[model samples]
Structure formats: structure tokens, C-alpha cells
Target chain A: MSEHGTTLNIEKFGSASEAKALSAEADDWTLIIRPQTGWFDLHLADLWRYRDLVTMFVRRDFVSFYKQTVLGPLWFVLQPLLTTLTFTIIFGNLAKISTDGLPKILFYMSGITAWNYFGECLTKTSDTFNANASIFGKVYFPRLSVPISIVISNLIKFAIQFGLFLVFYFYFLFRGSNIQPNSMLLMLPVLLLLMAGLGLGSGIIVSSLTTRYRDLRFLVQFGTQLLMYSTPVIFPLSSIPEQYRWIMIANPMTPLIETFRYAFLGTGTVSWGMLGYSAVATLVIMTVGILLFNRVEKTFMDTV
Target chain B: MSETVIQVRDLSKRYRLGVIGGRRLVDDINSSMARLLGRQDPLAKVDLLPGADKQKAARSDEMWALQNVSFDVEKGAVIGIIGRNGAGKSTLLKILSRVTAPTTGEVRVKGRIASLLEVGTGFHPELTGRENVFLNGAIYGMTKAEIRDRFDEIVEFSGFEKYIDTPVKRYSSGMWVRLAFAVAAHLDPEILIVDEVLAVGDAAFQERCLGKMEKVAGDGRTVLLVSHNMSTIQQICKECIMLKNGSIHKVGAPGSVVSEYLSETRVATNVDLTQWQDRTGNGFAKLSRMAFLNADGEEAGIFPIGTTICFDLETTYNRELIDPLFEVIIHDPAGEPLMHLRSEHDGLRIGKVNGRTSVRARVDNVGLYPGRYFVSARIAAGGRNVDFPRLCGSFQVTPSPGRHGDLRLNPKWGKYHLDSTWTRGDQ
Candidate 1:
């Protein structure tokens, strides 16, 4: 029997815990029945034990998107590929946007891959309250599972795009194109991390806000498009004039996108210090996002 | 001794009833601006305090959906939470299930909780029924293998095998509810919370659901049920809790709690609409009040099934009323209409009753089940008529020991035959 049960043993305790404890005490699950006062004092251990639920949510998100469509999961790859081609033709040729000496197709494809992950994460997370209000009002699961699952689900789209990016990289190399490798390639994971963190953080924050103001819901779609322009998705970071460079650097996503391009093509500028600042900023945003989300999860149904 | 699985203390939830319009936006912005200045806003002051029911007097301000509610459930206890509309029964379940937080107080629960608050709420409309079963079960925290083990059970329970591969949107509403309920009931959880979702299905399905709930209760799992159906509550719940105006009115054995609820709500000879002042509808003829008189011509709140009664109804029309036909319907607690009487069938009509008029209906043998019933009246002129409006009356038909089989009188011609002259000629 567990210590808590033994302390209040008016009746004989079940041997379920004792039997498991005999083999390995570490392996035995602990059930805590705490009287929590507010949202700040959540039972984290219980949430941890139910991590499988988070996984299931992610699976549901991924599978349901492609279940009935004729093209199915292939749309995951095609969506980004088509967007990259459109940007290449319009921004690269017609508008003549600077790609910083890299091939137009590769530059736009890389940006689309990173940007799509963030955009999907933000849009999905922002709409969480409105989309799942019906279910959230009925069941009791760790609400964090929802945003976490969104991030994971969007990763599938990113992975498919990444595969296309790899194909383009190999094709450029086989065509005898001049692309050199640098130590900055090691920073790709960090860039991906920053993108994921920023999207999830910003998404959850806006999602919570939209539950109340509802005006935020209207802004979410338009705001995401405007936000893309502020980031160096189609243009090189170096093209920004000196006076506006500081503003671009402070955008956080600027350093992230710059580092990703520099690592892949060895053409754009890479600043380790700027990348470090962006990473720290992403972490801070995610923490605040989580806090706001926790508070909102408790009362969202009332407002929703 | 049975284990105690859930303990609740002083749980209450307050909901703000904001006005529906652009004015609400101004209040919201003003509150945020006031907070920026480190000052309290005028609109924030409208928040209802915990345990306050006075806030409901105004329709625009916040309402305390739940107030000072407290109860505990023993392990394996099947508790029915009963109340009138807006009594906070659903809010209480939401709090217990952790879907929403209480404004004040705490709940200590032991074991994994599963709430069927809305059957198949997690289901995707475009997904196949089979796919939804797995998806919903997984969302409820069951493992894929666990769902696989229960898949056949779920399919059988829903009885939707023919359409299992079809998308849920294509299924009929009843089939959707059945599939949703099937997934919820099959997932074994230590504590099960169910709302009034079972009312969506047909009679046989409802009976089957009741049987399933009984079986779940018998398995030593804790169950919290919120429902308006008193008969279902009495059948399945050993204990009951009564909520009134967002507060705990009573909690104990099912019989006592239900009876207390009935007695507390018992009206005299006349029905009062003053308490239910708030009304919802386009302006038409409205039922303001009603009454039922006993043999002594005194107001009788309750009566036996066989008792003769005089039902008096008062209604006010918003527009012209001419050649109005009135109808009264009596429904059981399950919302199944037991008896219907229309004034037109009996050649009873009022010509051009334009204003408020008290119409009296003399009824004989008002056969009813031994439960609470709602009486609604409708008035119509020609083809167009007022929606069933002014008949907000509830009455109880006390159970009689002598009436064994059914509540209604079953007439027979065995002993009371007067014309017996040719009875021997047939032989």
C-alpha cells in the first residue's frame, strides 16, 4: 500500500500499489489527490502521466486533415512547393527581389518551409479556443495538450516541405551550381527551434485573447500575412537600409530566417550573437504564452 | 465499506451576462484602460459575487450560475444532480470534470476522470463513424489498443454497423448520438460524468442507455449524472442533489431530495409568472399565468390522476385576436406528450378576445404519471396562431397505491353491462 493510504487505513488498502512497489518503487504510479486553490497550483504529475493523451491529440490533428481528400497527405508537400514556385516567379523575377547571390528557387523554398511551420502553428493555436470550445467544455484533459499537439501536427507539414527542400538542394548540387558548406549549417536545428517556439508562443497568446475580445479573431488572418512581410521571407536581410536594419534585427524572426538561409546556402550573413538573442526572445515569449494559456483555459468556456 | 472518491467544498461559479451589442465592446475597452491606470472599472463592478442570487434580477448583468454548492460522493455512488433550468447542474458537472473552474472553492478527486458532458464532442464531422470511435476514445484518454479491444462492443452498442464506414455527417442525428454515446460509455474510467445528452435518442435507446448507466454504477465506479428526468434519476441514482437558484437546496437520498424539490416548488391554486418575468420569443400572445382548482374550488398545486379539475389560464395578446382556438397539452417528465385537448375539437371558441382574458377549462380524469408535468396552452386565429406561450404551469400527480398497472384508467365492460337480455340466446 502507498504511504498516503496507510496513513488513513480504516479499511484494508488494495495491494495493487504494493505489488508494483515490490518490483520497482520508481516504476509504480503515484496518485495525488490535492485540493488546489487556483489555476497556478495544477497537478503536474497527473498531466505527465496522461502524456499519451497529448500524443493522441497530435495524431488526430494530423490524420483528420488528410483522411478524405483525393490527394491525401501529398497535399502536405504540394502546398509548400506550389507556394514556393509562386513566390519565385512573382518576387524573384517580376519584382526582382534580392536573393543574396543564392538561386531563387532554393531561397524561396527554404523561407516557405520555415515560415509555413510558424504560420500554421500560429493560426491553429490562435483558433484553438473557438475551434474546440465544444469539446473543451465537456472533457477534462491538460489544456496544454492542445497547443502542444498543434505544434507537433504542423511538424508533419514542415517535414514534407523539408524533404522537398532537400531534393532542391541535391538538384542544385548535381547541376554543378556553386553552393559551399559552412559551420553555420550546425545552426539549422536552432533556427527550427526558434521558429517553433515563436509560433507556438504567439499563437497561444493570441488564442487566449481572441476568446474575449473576438476582434482578435478578425485580425488573426490578415495579421499573419502582414507579419510575413516584416520577416525576410522573400528578401535578404542585408537589403534593409541602415536606418531600418535595427528595427528588422529587433523583429526576432529576422535573425532566425537569416541564420537559416546562411546555413543552407552560405550566402546570407550569420551572426551567432543575434541568433542567441532571438533564441532567448523565443523562450521568453513561450513562457508568457503558457502562463496566459493556463489562465484562459479555466474560464474560456464561459466567454466562448 | 465503499470508498469515497470525490469531495467537493464550497464550489461556486459566476457568469457575467453582458449586453448583446456594440456597447459591450466599449465596456471591455474601458475596463482594460482602467486597469492600465491601476483603478477599478465601473463595468467590472458588475461581476456577481459568489453565493449571490440577487444578480439574476437584471437580465443584462452577471448571473451567479452556481453558488455555495457543496457535496461529496462515495466510491461507487451514483448521484443524480437535479434542478430546474439554469439551476447550475451543468455548471457543477463542468467544474467536477475540470472543463471549467469554479469561481470559489475546491474539489478533491481520486482516480482518472471521464466525462460524457456532450456525447462525441471530440468527434470530427467529416470522419467515418469507425474512425470517430477511435478518435473520440483516444481523446478521452484510452489507448489505441484499449479502443481496439472495445471496438466490437462500441459497434454493437451503437447498432450502426451498416454505416460504420460512412462519415458521421451523413448519419442521421439519432445515429450520430448513438455512436457518440457508444464511444463514451465503452471507455472505462474510474469516475464518469454524464450530462443530459442521452435525451437526444429514441425511447429504446434511452432505455438501453439507462441500463448501461446502471451497469456502470454496479461496477463500483463513481458516476455523477445531471438530468431533468426525475423518473430516470429515481431509477438509477441512489442519492440526489437539488440545486435552486445557483445554490444547493438539498442533498440526500433520491426520494427525499426529489420530494423536497417538488414541495419547495409547489404552487397554490394559481400559477405565478412574476418569478419567471424574463421571456424569450417574438411578441405574440403570451401566457402570463394559469391555475388548477380542486373539487372544493380551492387552488390545488397537486392532485390524484383521477381527480376532476378546473384549469384556468390567463393570456395577453400583442396583436389582434379573432376566432381564437385554444389547446392544452400535458407531457410527462420525459417530455413525452401524455394527453392533448384542443378547444376546437370540443366546439369551444372565443370570438375576438383581443385583450387579456382568463379562460377556464373543466377537465375530467386528468390521467398523469406520478411525476412533475408541464402544461402549455396555444391560441390560434384561422391558420396563424400564437406559439405555445402563456402556459407555464407545472403540477405533480401523486402516486396512488390502488392503481397498480398504469396511471390512466383502463375502461372495461365486464361487470357494469346493463343490456343482458340476449346473453343466453348465443349459447
Candidate 2:
């Protein structure tokens, strides 16, 4: 709202009079920082106002990943690649988990690529409170910009890893390796959303809890690793006995990974009711996560 | 009508003591279990405030860092918040900046605010100076285009142009602070809040920063400056708020408020270092007392110009010291370093003070311009700082009324007036 400074005369900022006009109309939107709010309160408009900060945070995360390394962005590609190869051997060849006649590489790579997106998001957003306490202690920005940026930056990593999976998919297709296409493949975007929403929700919850008890941090890392087993990343859901299959289906992540596998590999189960349940559960967790996150962001500085 | 850029009402902050604020799982479980069994929680309460009432304070662990403190700021006012350590200056800034919420009360602001509570924060060591400028700018809420528009100016101001593309990790810590402050100085927010962390910058850079702050203040942006340097605050700020024990003690022109701050609550001056209770160094040695001596070997609070001004540091050693070194730093009233006298610098190793011992340092022909000056004392055994009081005590170098010639000292012109023979002949 300061239009008189020479700073506004800078070319990219447009005219000082424009800021005057804007401030004149925005008279009633004064931001009042209060001590308390309802658990669900969020300054979404303020977050929108700090969009530049979100972009900057994302850019920082993107560029600072591979400093001093010979292979920078290549790590994005190699992480899922190495994990997929390891899964193909440890579970596919050794334990003999069925991929329902789908190519082992294709089946396992998709799962890792899909789940890794959520795991990366979870890990980064979980550290949002602890890692940024110094900066948070100094300046005031919409704190949510931090966790949101983690999700956006992890989205970029997911896209690159997803592209690597695509290359292998086409290579197997040329080799006629029985990787089939089905109408369910169109469900990929929805499945991706469920993954992101679930990841962000659980992440902020853990992050919020860790501000009080740091013991949750160790649990978060171990929990994310253990969660993959419950979600069927290595083995398809059909490989399990029907009586025990319900245990995997009970996990909020199972239906998402299962559906992703079903859509691409055309060999796994997909239930409309289970998908609905996953979406509903994700919504509930997300609401709870955001409420707890907002509560913690208010005074975490003192405790942190 | 002119706007009130920031307004606050009944602001307060409470913090718990005896814990790191990280409550362990066991503690949480024990508390919950007590609640379930209808028993009282062991960590029920404690008074954490610096000055709290006796009976209630005895029962609670919570500290009220700020208590019912409130003030309003008119648009474009350059106000200084001055306080000693633990006076809640930083906490008040944190609340105003919305970095943390108050335990009670509310703050309303009418414009975008940019605050820097710490210097060189958010600077990635691996990022280049160019990238960090943009990165830190954006972190402060400036858009990329804004940083791009001002990139040349930033690079030039930081004087890192020759190495702009090089990674910041290679830059010295001072260069990093310069770059960070350069980016923060250019913020175009409607309200600017700055903390004393700028003290980290060298004197020249700090001068430039104050000049820039003055220009920004003139540009009609409200500025709230916090610092322990009374002179710097008085130089730039028209009005000041002096905080005492977490409340506003006075709000008036900088001159009166600063004098009030100086006279009544000078932290530790002339106190024998041994009895200086706010020490954080190991218990091996204590600065017992600081003695200001005149030419007659008697204690003196005032000295004439061109005289040897001597101060004796009496330190009581709890443990035997090795190669014990003493250091004294004198600063002008403006908080600028005028001299650093170190026993080690003089190639003298005064060893092993088993008990009460004294070291004396003298500035011969104390050609200092006649004005106010203060000294900070330090003792380092081996290489670690032992007893370093920021302000040991203040003294006046009163001008001799009939003093003339090259010795006609002008305190306003410079801090020191060294002895030199003037030869004004044609040669």
C-alpha cells in the first residue's frame, strides 16, 4: 500500500498510481492477527497473496537439490529406477510375488513411481516445521506456503520419474511384453490426486504433532517405510489370500495404488466402493491435518 | 485521513520454563493418566515472568514474557524499540511481525510488512550469490520480477558482482551478511520491522544500512527498529519506546527515552566483574570489579583530555589459569569500536591467577576527543572468551575549557585525537 516510495517507480512494478488505486479499493481487507481461531481456520486468501513466496520456495527446493553433485536432476530419475530394480529382484524373483502376468519391471516401476511421489511429499512436508523454524522465527509469511511448496516441488520430481516409467513402458510395448491397455487407465489423474491429498494430509498432521513431541519424527520415517508394505507396492493385492486381502484394502493407500496398478497393468482389482472410501478418508484426514497444522503454526515458534 | 499502519491492544506472551518445550511422550502419557484418574498434574504451574507476584509465581512454571503491552504506530513513523536483554523487545517484534501469536490480545495492520529478525537467514550455502538474492528476496515476499528489476542494484550494493555467480558457500560469513542485508534493504513493504541482528554487519555497512533506513523512512514507510545501540537509535528514530521488564516504560522523543534507558538501567558498569551476576562463562574466573583510575591513582569518573586514562580489571580466579589474557574494547557512545587493547596483542602472557588478581591497561596521552566512552572487558584463557561484559562502565572525557591548538578536541568530528607535533612552516 506504500505508493510514494521510489521503489514503485521501478519498471517491472508498473506505476505508483496503480498501487494507489488498488489500495484505495482494498480498504476493508485489513489483516488482523489474533491470538486464537477455530481449529479449521485458514487464511487461504493470504496464502494466495503470498503466491510469489510459494513459487520461490518451490524454486529453491528444485535448484538446491543437487548442489556440487555431478548428476543433479538425474537423481530424480535414478531414485525410482534403483528402487524399482531392487523391488523386482527382492519381491518378484526371490519371494515370487505375482504381477498377474504383467511385466515385473512395468508393474513394480509404476508402483514405486506412484508411491514415491507421496512419500517424498510426506517426508518434506513433515520437516516443514522443524527445518524452517529459524526462518519462521524471524519473518512472517503464510506458513502454509512452506508445506504447499513441498507438495509442488515433489510434484515435479514425480513428473520426471513418471516420464522415466513411460520410456520403459513403450520399450516393453515394442517387445510385446503383454503390458495391456484398459479403459481404467484414464483413472490415473484421480488416483494421483488421492495420493497427493493423502500424503499432504498425513504429512502436516505428523509435522504438527512433532512440534510438541519430537518422537513422532522417528515414527513418521519408519511409518512411511512400513506403510508401503501395507499398500502393496511390491506385490499385487490379488496375490494375497482373499481372507487376508481385506487387511491391505483397509489401508487408505491400498485402493489408490491398487487402482493405479489396475489401470495401467490391467491385472489388479479396482472397486468403485473402495475408491469412494479412499476419497472420503482422504478428505477427512486432510481436514484434520490442516486444522492441526493451522493450530500449530500459530505458536510453534515459541515451542520450536 | 492518514492510516495507522499497525495497531495492537493488550498484547501479552507466556512461555513455560523448566522444559525445552519439547514434551516427551512419557510426560504426555503421565499427564493424561493423571487427568483420567482425577489427580493433579505435577507440572501444574510456575511463574516464568521476570518480575511476578510472589505467591502465584511460586506455583507456576509459565513466564509472561510480555504483559499487557500495547502501542499503535502512525504511518511512516520511524520508531525505535529499545530494551536490555530479556526485556521482551524481540518477543514484541515477533508478535508485531506475526511470526508468533500473542498469548492474549490482538494486532491489526493495514499494510504489507517485511520484518528481518535475523540476518542472513534462508541463505543456502550452495546457492550462488545471484540466486540467493532472488531466493532471499522472494522469501521476503518480493516477486521474481521485482528482484530482477533490482538485481543489478543488489549485486552492486553487496559488492559481490565479481563473484555473483559463484556459490555463496565460498563467500566469507561477512560477505554473506552483506548480501543478505542488501536484499532486505530493498524491500518495498508498507511497514518494515528490523531487529538488532544488523549489529553483525561491520561499521561501514551498518552506516550504509542506517542511511538506507533513513531514506526508506523518508520514503513514507513505517519503520520499527529494535536495537541495544542507543546512539544509532537516537540518530535515526524520531520517537522511541523503551521496554522494561516486558512493558513499555516510556514513549517519547529518542533523546529523553534513551537517556532514561541509559541512566537507570545501564546493565553492568563499574561493577567488579566477580560480582557481575549475569555471567555465562565457566566458573573458572570471574570479573570481580572494574576500577577507573585517575593520574593520582584514585578512583575517578571523569578525566581531562591528553591524560593517561587507566582502568584496572580485578578478576578472581576460581581455577588456575594458563597464559591468561585480558582484553578491553572501548566504544564511542555511538557503539562504534574505538580501541581494542589486548595483553596477548602486546606479547605479554600474564599467567596463573590462583585467586584475586588485577591487570591494568592504560591509554597513554589519551588523545580521545572529549565526550562519553565505555569499555567492555574480556578474559580468555587459552583461546576462549571468559568474562566479557558488553558495557563494563561508562566514563566522561571532559574537555579542558582553555585547551587550544591541535589539541582543540572536536568530539563530533571523530572519536580519537592522537598526539602529533604540528609543523606549519612553508616546508
Candidate 3:
């Protein structure tokens, strides 16, 4: 009796709250479902209610990220550092791309750190429908949580790479390098938000499309690579000829990379107009992405 | 009276048939453009209409899995949905659980519903038992605090406390199922929808989970269950809805509905039943074949009166079994059971049996009156029946000469025949 009292006690178990959710007059209401009348039906409040689910997804992704690898989390730091070295050798030494007078290695590392987050967000979110078809087929969850967790999980990797950049920055600074971080460093968060929004927006759109047309998956892979060259990953935005500046600036990510560099290295272009333009473009793409994602998530299991 | 918790109105789901579900790029672009232009999807007339990819699509390459189905359930109601494969029973559960959307109509649910379609729907193999409990709890929409409070009870119920911290990948399938069922049953669902997920566990575990579900229903919470096990529905569900060919065939008390389902499958008895779906057992042993026999102990369909009535039950064991009991039951043409026989009850010992053994249970001089009767055979071990073929096979009984000289027997007389002597006596 005591054992049943301890475990099976309804009130103590706190499931009564979920029950209370039913007794409320609101829960008993009718929900009319039909072909969506409009483009957007984002269930924001439901997503908020399932924040714990999103947290678990993020934890699962991050924890399982390096489960069996011998080097484990050390690979987090090693990956970006090695990439920066390769970029320093190839783009900086061979091609001799201008970094706007910033140290070539530091410049490449910062760019890689910022661009890596965006690339991870894009690839991971693009695979959401295909990779999670097993779970989505059996369970009811805010499908948005899957992509949201991808963005957040990739942020942890971004943070590790960013920390490595900081370590190098301090090393060069204490060793009497001429570079100094500018006040634009405060714009770092806005720059990251733009990248995340763009990646998430484009990722969901491609993922939703790939549910029916799988070719988008391969396109996303090569597309993200080609997209990096168009952005100022190795070269500063100022290095682009003035005539070609419009083409570079048109790629919304170009302004993000330039702003991020200007904040850390204090040498690239950062403007209220360009940042505002990129922000508006990102918001619009995100709105479209969400609509497509919402439309496809309900029935993607059949096609995916 | 409890209020109606679920009201499904004209619910329908349509699904395309075969491997063409992944639409070609050309067709998808055309459909998307049509939607953008505010036109009915041209493909939807022939394929899934976007959200209507669940079941029963009826067009060129499509078929409607469910068509205009409607039902209502009151709070505290334990309702069962029974159907053959592709009868849309699962599609209905998916709609009610909100796992899939109905193509047309609306279902208003007045409670926080949780559906256990599969016991380990989202269980991660890499996660420890404790971690999976919380993960699975959250998947059921249980809050963290609720899971934390119920954590110990769940572990106790599963009887895996010592291995709670061990990764579930290392656990046996049975052990994994127990933990998953334990978590699913304890999640405090106001309206629980279960779909044959509880069928995987051992009989005792299945019984305990069924008891917990009954307790939940007894608390005036609604439950919708789908199972092929007729006895399970009869045990917990008061009402049963039988679906046939994607529509509601009947809805009434569990007895009539279950009997109807049983009779429908009676025609399939002519074929081998090794692939039959509706059976419950630990699966250590299986009944391969069942046949009625005559005095010679050879397989026969007709038995004469005053002749030995017996049956041959072939047993196959994947692993060795101990003291397994093989039994047969005879039912008259009226569907009333005439006799129940168990090898163990008859004091027949089948100790330490392995693969491919046949056993017989017979009564010298058939006591049953001549008529047609049915037989069902099963093997049981560890207090649980394993291979129970609902209708094993049927045979005919006819009259022959006895000591009393050609005494005919039929259903008009009582089922049993007793030898008697008439002598000169004073009244």
C-alpha cells in the first residue's frame, strides 16, 4: 500500500496538471483542420510549451556528436584550427587574397568560425525531414523543434571555434600585434542572428522541397560550398572590385561575414544600411522558409 | 454521466498506393505552383492532397484508406477498435492521436491525449534506461517535474533498478519492452490511445500493464485501444468498433464485436496457421499442426460413436521447454464448448522437450454424441498458453453400432453419453 501510495499517487505524480489542461474550458474547444487557408500557421505557443523537448533534442545531438570517436571533444578545437591553417596556406599564400591588412591566419579563422555555424545549420536542417522520418512517423512533436535544435546544437560547435579564435587573438595581442577589436564587436550577436536566420530559413526550404524532390539534397551540399566563395570568407569585402561589390553584397551572407570581421579585426566594412538590408532579406526568407516547413512537416513522412 | 471527450466528425484519410510516394520534381513544382495560384491541386485529384497522405487515396494510383468515418467517445470510456490489416484501424488511431491529420472533417478532443502506438517509439539505444525514461516521458508530453516525481515508480515497475544507468542497447528485447511499457503506462495520460504496443511483453507484464490501463480508465479517463487480441479487448474495453475495408462495419458491446471478428476469420482455417496474427504466448514453443483422429490414432475428419476420440498436436520449440502442456478444446456446432483437455491435467508428463514432438490426447469410446464439432489446440509452459490457434480445425461425429446395438446419437440428446443397465427392479 505504501509503495502504491508513493508511486501511483495522482496528485504527487503531477500528471494532474496535464489532466487539468483538459478540464480547462480552453482545452475542450473544437479545432477545425483543413487545407491551410494562408501560407503561415506557425504554432509558436505550442513550440514554447515544448521548450523542454527542444532542450532534449539539443542535448541528444551534442552528446551523441562524438560518442565513439577517440579524440572526442578535442576534435571540436582541432577541426577549425586545421581548416584555418589550410585556408592560410592555400588562400592566403597561393592565391594571395587580401585580408584588408589583418593577419591572414586570424582573418581566415574568424571567417571559418562564422561560416561554419551557418553551413552546419544549413546541412543539418536540410536533412531534418529525411533523417527524422522514423521519429516523426510515430510521434507528435512540434516539427519545428527539430530544426531549432539543429541550429542550437551547431552553435555549441561554433562557440568552441570562436573560443579558439579568441585564444589566438589574445596571443597576437599580447605579443604586440597592431590589431585592436573595435566597438563594432558589440554587433557580433546581430551578425550571428543574421547567419542563423539565413541558414535556418534556406535549410528548411531546401528540406521541405527535398521531401518530394530529393535532388535538392545534393544541391544543398554543392550549393553551400559555392555560396562560400561568393561570400568574403577568405577576402575582405573591400578587396572585391567596386563594380562587383553589388553582386557580393547581394548574397545576404556577404554583409554578415564583413560585419563579423569588422567587429573582431576592426578593418572590414560595417554599415547601418548594409546590415539593415541583410536583416530584412533574412526575415523575408525565414518567413517563406517557415511556411514551406510548416506545410511539408505534416505529411513529409509519406514521401521522405 | 461522463462528458464526450472525443467527437470525430466525418474524418477521412487518403493515401496513394505503391512506391511513387516520393513525387518527381516536375509534379511537385506543378503542385506547388497550383497552390500558389489558389487552385485545387491537380495531383491531389490523383494523389495525396498535401496533408492527406495518411490512408485511403482513391484515384488513378490512389485509394481511400478511410472514408467519412465518424465516432464519439465519452470520458471514462474504454473503447476498442478491431479490424483486419488495411482496415484503417491504425489510420483512425493516428488521426485521433494527432500523429496524422485527417484529409477532411474535424475531431475535437477535450483532453490531453497520449498515444502509445509502439512501445519503444522513440527510445534511443545509446541512452541509459534512466535517461530514456525522461526522454520518453517528455515525448509523451509529460513535464520534467512529473517525470522526476514518477521516476522511482517507473524503475520499480520495470524491475530494472540495477540496470537503470546502463545503456538500453545492452538489454534484451523483453527487458527493453518492459521498461518502455512501464514508462508509457505511468505518463498520466487523460486520454490514452494504445495500438497493439502492449502485445510485445510477456503475459505477466502485459497483464500488469493492462491492469494499470484499467485503473486509469476507472479514474474516469478515456481510453481508445486497438488490438488483434480479442480477449484483451474483451478484458478491458466495454465497447468495440469493428472496421472492415476502411469503414465502420459494426460498433457494439465487446462480446458481439469480438465474436463477429472471430467468425470472419473462421473461413481461413483450411490453410496452415503458422503465419496467423492473433495469438498470445511467450513463444518458447509453438503448435505446428492440429488434427482430429479416430481409434487408430491416424488423422481423420469423422469419428464414429463408441470409437476413440483423439487429436494429434504437433509441437515445435525454438528452444527447449520444460513441462509444456498441450491441450485441445471441442466445441459443438452451436458454438457451445463440449470439452476442454490438457495433457498436464491428464497427468501426461512432457519433460525437457526440444524440437518436433507430436502428442495425442484421446478418450476411449467417444463420449460425445454424434454431430459436428470444432477443435482448438495450444501448448503452454510456465503458466501461460503459447500457441493458441483460435479455431484449430473442425471434424464430424457420426453414430455407429455400440453394445446397445446401432444406437444413433445427435444434438437432440444431451452432449454426453453414459453407459447404463436396465434390470428387473421393484418400484
**DockQ (0 to 1) for model 2:** 0.32
Q: Give the TM-score (0 to 1) of chain B in model 3.
A: 0.61
Across all models, the iRMS values in order are 10.1, 11.8, 13.4
Candidate rank order under lDDT: 2, 3, 1
Order the candidates by TM-score, highest first — what do you get? 2, 1, 3
lDDT of 1 by residue, B1-427 (tens): 4444665666667676663221344567888899899998767544344443343434336666776555556678899999877788888887877778888766767777888877787877777898888778877878778889999999998887899999888988888888988898897888888887776577777777888899999998888888878877888998888877777766778999888877867764576653554344444677667787876777888877667677787878787778777777876666666667787888876877767887777776655545687776666667665656433677777755434443332221111112123346767
DockQ of each: 0.23, 0.32, 0.17
TM-score of 1: 0.85
Give one digit per residue, the lDDT tens place, for model 1 in A93-186. Answer: 9999898888899999888888898898999899888888778877877777788889888887788889989999889978967676678888
Give the alpha-carbon lDDT of every model: 0.75, 0.80, 0.78
Top lDDT prediction, candidate number: 2
lDDT of 2 at B210: 84
Off by over 4 Å in 2: A1-29, B18-21, B35-51, B54-59, B156-163, B172-175, B266-269, B272-283, B291-310, B321-323, B331-337, B343-353, B362-374, B380-402, B405-413
Model 2 chain A TM-score equals: 0.88
Residue lDDT tens for model 3, B310-381:
677777889988888888888764344678998878899979999889887888877677655667778888
Give TM-scores of the second chain, every candidate: 0.84, 0.83, 0.61
- Report clashes for each candidate as comma-separated counts: 3, 17, 11
Window of ten residues with lowest summed lDDT in model 1 chain A: A1-10
Off by over 4 Å in 1: A1-47, A67-82, A181-183, B18-29, B32-62, B160-162, B274-281, B294-298, B381-385, B400-427
